[model samples]
Target: MTSRRLFLSTILAGLTVPALARAALSGAQQAAVDRVTDWMKGLKTLSATFVQIAPSGALTTGRLWIQRPGEMRMQYDPPANILLVTTDWRLVFYDGTTKQVNYIPVAQTPLGFLLARNPDFGDEVLIRDVEVTGGEIRITAFSKGNEDQGSVQLVFAEKPVELRRWTVFDPGGTKTVVTLSDVRTNQDIDQELFVWRDPQLFGYPDLD
Candidate 1:
């Protein structure tokens, strides 16, 4: 059985950031970061279909539901048998294959800053690089005081300022790229989507 801790550790171990000889965010870069932060904080709810490519190139498809200020659910497709959710203070992982649930303190995960009440580009997260290419804004950052935890790169489409995809690089230099499609924002998402239930009891059906 693959516990959540083991899974997370496998992807998030031995990560380090190389110091870059760069100055503070330029005026344009700062504006772009602020635009993204402002857009992110204004999002109350978001739902989308996602394709996640793991470091080893394994792919998983899922539906993602997010409610800001600390709530989210990533429900994987068949054969994956995984559900990752976040609450105010914890990150929960449900394994449908083994009917086991794992919990980790939110503060220990990069998700903590992402789901914060006011996710900004400073302090909690240090914006490392910002670029604009083909009408898309790419912002990369690492958790402050814990750069070894890994890094997050967020890509947004401009004109409408929509989040298109994000890539997470774990400590071992393994990258997980998630691309979003069919996104619906600020919609009324059901509270139950964020709730954790025993898959064997009434949720996901087990694979025989």
Candidate 2:
């Protein structure tokens, strides 16, 4: 089954940044966006684990691979049978149970719109507030009308913008927390891995 961690991690992790330091980040919200942007600007590729969790307690984990200027692929673990991939112009999902590979033009997805029109990390999703405690940067994003149209909280590492964790809360109160670990950037990735293929033909379309 999918680990529940990977699904939301990949999308929510892309929460844009906020306005210029009006005052300064005494805590997380201010520092995180700047730190993450600084770090990402120096790299070319990013890979990590992503997750999504349902309130019922199911979990899904996927390999989160990202290529700069907009490219990513998240392949869920066994049994869950779901894959979310971005091939520049498309954001595709293959559902095993449905035996259908559903794809939407990147222009249509809320997340896609964020990446396509604002990949620079500027103009954050809009920060509702920021607080610092102990050693974490805790930032809450704007309301539903914000960039990604969701409310979220991001926790930044003490060192910099390397996001340690984040949570996305939908209008209905459903929440997904994503924890990022073993982050590596500038690694070479094979181009073939991002392409979409038929699960029926591959026998494990879910894995493909």
lDDT top scorer:
1
lDDT for residue 89 in candidate 2, whole number 0-100 = 74
Q: On a 0 to 1 TM-score scale, where does candidate 1 land against the true structure?
A: 0.86
Off by over 4 Å in 2: 1-32, 105-124, 142-149, 203-208
Best by TM-score: 1
lDDT of all the models against the reference? 0.73, 0.58
Model 2 agreement with the true structure over 55-138: per-residue lDDT tens digits? 556676767776765677777777777777788578777766666665666544334422343444324345556766677766
**lDDT score, residue 194, model 2?**
74
